[model samples]
Target chain A: MSKEFIKGNEAIAEAAVRAGCRFFAGYPITPQNDIPEYLSKRLFEVGGNFIQGESEVASVNMVFGVAATGIRSMTSSSGPGLALKAEGISNLAGARVPSVVVNVARGGPAIGTILTAQQDYLSATKAPAPGGFKCFVLAPATVQEAADLVYEAFDIADKYRTPVYVLADGMTGNMMEVVELPPMRELSELPSKDDWRVNKLEQDGNFRSISSYSPTAEGLQEMNEASEAMYQQWDKEEQRWEAFMMDDAEYVVTGYGSSGRIAKSAVKELRAQGIKAGLIRPITLVPFPKDAFDQIDYGRIKEIFVAEMSIPAQYADDVRWATKSKLEIISVLTSGGVILETEAIVDAVKERV
Target chain B: MEKSLLIAGFGGQGIMLIGKMLGFAASKAGMNATFYPSYGAEQRGGTANCTVIIGDDEIGSPVSRRLDTLIAMNEPSFVRFVDRMKKGGVVIVNSSLVQSKVEDKDVKAFYIPANDLAQELGSVQVANIIVLGAYIAATGILDAEFAKQVIAEQLGRKPEMLELNMQAFDKGMAAVK
Candidate 1:
């Protein structure tokens, strides 16, 4: 496959189309607007449906509706918009709808800025909604990874019968890079949903009922237990991370998405400066890659740096939990649309190393 | 080897296109490249800029804090980004719009009247291509032929414009030489 220089949002959108996604419903938002903007025309050209929903909430619900028919579907938004779509996302999880929801995250506690940030770490991985269910989160640090992960997300979602979240940031969404796109999935090769899809009643005569509600407490308990079981399976099998220059690393840096990407350069600079610094970039954020921390030589390592674009450091909590707070953890942070500089990260590591 | 450059100017000066062309050319030449634009409210009559990084290694960050090259299309762009450049960096200033001069002794500076060159070519819009041509000739990081190929593909829809752009590219290369 020939690589082409394309923006992350466009790559993701194209990947989704290649992955057999026949439907997309989304509202406009900065940073991530390109995803839907690309899809608006791209999807239609593939004979797929593209709807610019009245609102983010409506868009997500529309995705939920499309997914119920056993069609691979998606919706995308930034921070504020993601918040609006939370209820629909929770509904998708509850109904076990295999769909992809992309959160091209931007700065915010609430409508903070249109610039990039990693503030949605907790919201995406921890509490996507009021439900006890979790969306399998894939955080991509590069445009190539963004396309690859989004291409994989549809399959991951179908396999588990759950919503998969591609947690990208504004930087990744806006930046253009050379990427080798995945080959298009044959529609015939796509998994059959005849037995489960509601719209297939004429063919299967199953008369399937898909709803987030189970009616009775006992039924709900059974549903929750089933969800719990699936989650356990995901946690056991899906934790993915990248260990960069960790062969003899005495200083470890942990981050995901854009933060992780920036930290990688920082790791290189630190290594150049005679510091054995390494980075653990989590490719999967929900199943949190906690075991990557185990690779650290705790006996010789100096410290751990938790870098993120969020102030008060939401991602650091996972790093702390993963390492069990055994070593001193330093946080390298920037907030409210400010980008994390590789030089600053190197400087921060220099202080400790 | 890795090279990072920034192209800055006011909106509508084709600032973003310059970065995209460089990135696409690098990619076509089988190298890794990242093009990150300063998007959003800044595009509304404000200064528009984009950073392009080309390297053999996997490019990590989309942006570089210390740029190896700076292509400033106007005075403000030169003023804003020159200091962020690494020492001994290559700077291509559009002398037609920029009154300020590069004072850094370590920096390899090229003062090109890109607008004037574009006027000679009959369109000021091709001024960016002129700068891009100078960048190629100055850096030699990428083959000039690859850039011409990318421009042909990018401007393929406008056949009449393609001939002018090709001449503009040649004019730019000659100016640097």
Candidate 2:
């Protein structure tokens, strides 16, 4: 019940440790170094493993190695560093390993500014490695969410038999917040090391393995079938979102991460102007909860808009996919450290009205 | 409803601490709040900033253009956010660092000499709290008692500076009138 003033980055590290993550491996990157730095100090005290890898690639692989043993493991990075771990992420996906990865995203496309941005949206959701996989993405808009979701990330990764991303922007990571550490849930035991962990099975009878290459066609097909089924099942269990002030909403403002905060201010202003503007914030980006948008009564909505910290519009694409183009999707997308301001959103709503 | 406030200033100026304190206070008041700070250029001698949102309803967007009220501890923050403020919004400025005067008929602007006020109390670090005290006093959004309670609870983080902080807040609130 102790409340401690902590940075979002340190909270993530602490929460992961508390959530039963036994291994911490990561490479340092701006707005994210605090994650490894904090974990390196804390993991040892808790009798866990924490390693700062030579590179993002090696760090991710180190995580993959531990996950292979069915022990809760994690690694974190920002955009450019995440790019370096792509192959490793893909390898883990192919092996159906359960692990948590935190992306304290910064402005990107290249070595973009250290300021927060959601530009890595598509790349994160659609794993670009050899085998296609979509992570369970939780885009946290606040420092509290950044702190709290590390535990949730572990739970979801284990439940779905895939990676769970505690996706946050640099703003959320670097921010200082006196986050209430929620009670850690009793973790579900991993499919016992006797049976759950590979190679740990007695060499007498079983040859349990975690590998990108399954020697037999049947083995490869079985792995693909297993992952696909797991993903679909996860979509059902993990689809999460929050709809705000929508009962009388004439318009729905869609956003996630930092942009969601801006949309909130605009909604209040638009409502004060007698416009029924509400917010549809997708907390889970992979499962996306399209039904939430699909279920909205189009006749009640005058328009829909998506706001974010990217130029070409990533979540905008998800919004479009949800509605069948019944409602015209407009985006208040801003690039770099900036995001859509409330004034800009109000103007957009006014034009729509 | 969840309200989000972005407080911008220099790193050592306690910009992040100010945001975090507000979040803790909001939670103490039984309102859900989230404080997010950004480091990098903002902290390394650029313009450090953070956002704190508290509301009765779920907070939708975490980003804001103009705040319901702004506690600008520096000149750049005042320059960057002054135009974005709601016409009748509350703008609490640090008159010590922001030498330039800004006047608007629509907005109620309370210019507190935050740095000077804190220094008078023997520490300049509590300047952000001074500005926060001014925000509470001028806007009347938070009760002075609650602000005091929050200050006391958060004192452990900077135990040495607690007395100066309370005095700084007192001076700041007095300056508002």
True contacts kept of 2: 0.62
Off by over 4 Å in 2: A1-6, A176-179, A185-193, A203-207, A245-248, A298-303, B1-11, B36-38, B43-47, B51-57, B72-80, B97-99, B115-119, B122-129, B143-161
Judge the docking of candidate 2 as incorrect, acceptable, medium or high.
acceptable
Kindly give the stretch of ten consecutive residues in candidate 1 chain A with the minimal lDDT sum. A199-208
What tens digits encode model 2's per-residue C-alpha lDDT throughout B57-144? 5564555665677778889988987776767777788889897665777877787888888888887777888888887678665667
lDDT of 1 by residue, A276-327 (tens): 8988999999888988887778888857888899997999988888888887
Fnat of every candidate, listed in order:
0.79, 0.62
DockQ of each: 0.84, 0.46
Residue range B37-122, candidate 1, lDDT tens digits: 98767855679999999999999887888989999999889999998878879999999999998888989999899999999989
| Per-residue lDDT over A164-265 for candidate 2, one digit per residue giving the tens place of the 0 to 100 score | 877888877876654667665344553444555685756677677777678899988888888888778767786888788988788999888777767877
All models, RMSD in angstroms? 1.5, 3.3
**Candidate 2 chain A least-lDDT 10 residues:** A185-194
State how far residue B41 of model 1 sits from its true place (Å): 1.2
